[model samples]
Target chain A: MSVLSLISGASIPVQLVMAILLLASLFSWYYIFLKVFTLRRAEKQTAEFERQFWSGADLTDLFQRAVNARDSAGSLERIFESGFREFTKHRREPGTDVGALMDSTRRAMRATYQREMDKLESSLSFLASVGSVSPYVGLLGTVWGIMNSFRGLANVGQATLSHVAPGIAEALIATAIGLFAAIPAVVAYNRFAGDVNRLAIRFDSFTEEFSNILQRQVH
Target chain B: MAAAAIHSRDEALAGGLALAMHVLFLVLLVFGVSWQHKQADTAVIVDLWRDLPSVTPPRVEPPPPPPEVKPEPPKPVPKVEAKPPPKPEPAPVVKPDIALKEKQDRERKLKEQQEAAEKKKLAAEKAREAELEKKKRAEAEALKQKQAAEAEAKRVAAEQQKARDALAAQQAAAQAKVVDEYKRQISAKIRRFIVLPPNVSDAAQVEFEITVLPGGEVLGAKLRRAANSTPAYDAAVERAILRAQPLPLPPDPALMRQFRELNLVFRPKD
Candidate 1:
């Protein structure tokens, strides 16, 4: 059977499966692109913030800059600003101990790091689901299509290969489409997950280093 | 700030490129454009070595039995009675010499007769032996000729059989081809004649058998099987078969026999 006929001749259930797989593939690709852009931006902004923070810029100036950027501030810069703001706020209170100031600052930085990691890891689960489930869905369609073809065979007095082949080819198309949807999603998910993990590690290390620096200031 | 703007623009560009690539991929898939690979046509290689006909050698005829030798009858011998010595020669002292000379002459004649008889018997024995040798040679020659004739006859018969087998095979293949063509023509003619009733909406198949004469006239048509169809549907199919009269048959009488009784199936929804 020709590829055109295989697809056009598919039964209703198989066609529906193919349509769902195509949509899933399209959306997975979109997320893949979006996540790539988001991760790259996050990495770039983190690097830029690190460079500025270590350039011997005054702490107050860096904090003011981060505050000015508001929601647009990078995750690392936001963590720095939040911790510094908490330190300053508690410092103004009479009889505030150095231990309490450091505790509050570290806690705030840790919370921001968690929020940043969550944002970076968003939409990855969808890619994972697409990769894992599409094949079975396609399999379901293929089984149904084959059952229908065999059912047709029962009506025929003599079953020739020509009678059954087109139906089978149409059925197999679903599996092909399923694999088409799955392979790329699986590969992209793996790569993105690794990238997000690396970013998370960087954020954790940055928070620890910032806490140590603040601890030195308190002394 | 400039870096931020460039970064956002780059993000937008990446997203746009990704979207464009995905769209292109999906379009290629739906249109079945990118999956084209040159499918190499498989060449069918016939093995002539195995298909060559094997030639069988003719059977050898056994040698003919030896000719019987017949004994010749003995020739009749002539009998001579000894004559009584008639009168003893009266002793005549004077004629003794004459008597002795006569006896000597008689003994010499007898010896000459016995030698002639012995020579005649030897010549007859030699002639008999020569005749026996000639008969043996003639028999051998006749046997060789007979065997050669038998072998020639066998070889001719085998060749004739092979030719007949080849002809039969060729005829069968041609007959099959003609039958297929005849079936196709009949189907086309029937389909052309058929005007399906509009009210018959269900998917139905009407199978019927048609009997045609050698001259291509439709003798009779009867419905063999009916499925999801009414009597009207069956009647229409039968009528169509009848209308396609004389039903294009192969010109060969042998091939025409195939269409004499034919089972045809008609599917309304096909």
Candidate 2:
């Protein structure tokens, strides 16, 4: 079947609406695939960084390099840089309170965490939009389809089940397509939200632990 | 504890990126709306006000302020005309049942005529084959005589009396006759073995699908559609098919080649 013709034959205004919905679905799905890869890559990098951090590397050397590599900063490396930079800067200031110094470092790290979270969350709202709106879009198409079906029935001499079947089939296809687009979107949005929350939790915990480390070292 | 905490961060980051991207994708998908083509709209309503002028609306009269005319006419009402009875519609011209019967008879005659023609053709062919066999035998005898004469000339010159040419001539003729007889026998056996279903009358027209093994035996038969079935008539046809199993295989390479698996349809009679 020619999908274009199938969609084109529907009511005019609805066809436009359906076209927009379909485009949104296509765009969302494409982004979904893209995000999956991007997230996977980010995860792999995070894992690699953590492994390196525990690989007997000197913390001071790691911190110095991370801080020095200011121009090109990875999210994880940036977070570390912010915390360590705050720590060194506080130590240098005369009579800086150790507890207060750690607090400044923690805030810097928290800011970096927010930035990273924003980057991670980018385009997530689009997914949310798609998840929420796709069904309504599909419903619009379906409503249009049903209207056309009724209009067609009005012209027919005798309306039998068979006579009405094709129109109904075409109409139902819109709702089905809408669900098809929406289900995956909703599921993906939920899953991604949960993952982002988990990651945020991890960032918060990391900041606390790093603050404790700074606390002991300075004190 | 610190290590455990750091590891959790790693896990969270990975999971977070995935969730964020997926959510974004879903949001974009839900809001996007392009499905129906704009060009398909065919709604139209035609107004009839412009088509025809009103017949009784040209002379508008104003109402009088007061009634001025006085009328007093006591007249008897005209008698109502007697109602005429509805004319009974002449009975619809019913053609004699002969038309249907004639058509049926014509079909039956045509079918019988076709069967007779087929039977006559088969008989004629069998007779022709017999004549050909007779001619073949005569030619074989003449060839044997010619060979015997040549052998006698060579035997006398070489002073060796040989029965070789005579024996070979007899064997050749015997083999030729045996082949011809075998073919004739096979044809007869085939004719006798086939029991075409009654419903599949020589007059019936239908396509059949029959699967067969290497053996001439019919493995299966089926009508691919109801259009092929002739009601309870198909029962008689099916019976004939079952009765005609294990068809006698012909020695003719051409016939045997196609005899393996085959389907054929007959109309009326062929």
Clashes of each: 1, 35
lDDT of 1 by residue, B127-201 (tens): 667766767776776677677667766776676677667766666666676577678777878888887876775
lDDT of 1 by residue, A1-219 (tens): 456667888999999999999888877877788788878878898999989988989999999999988656788888888888988888789887888888998898888888878887888999999999999988988988999999999999999998897788789889888888888889999999999998888888887888888878877
lDDT of each: 0.78, 0.63
CAPRI grade of model 2: incorrect
Question: Which 10 successive residues of model 2 chain B have the least lDDT summed?
Answer: B48-57
TM-score of chain B as predicted in candidate 2: 0.24
Query: Which digits, one per residue and each the tens of the lDDT, describe model 2 over residues B29-142?
Result: 445545445797789974333323222223323332233222333233343333333343343444677677766766776677667667766766776677667667667766
Best candidate per lDDT, number? 1
Which ranges in model 2 have alpha carbons more than 4 Å from their true place? A1-5, A68-73, B1-270
Alpha-carbon shift of residue B209 in model 2 (angstroms)? 54
C-alpha lDDT (0 to 100) for residue A75 of candidate 2: 64
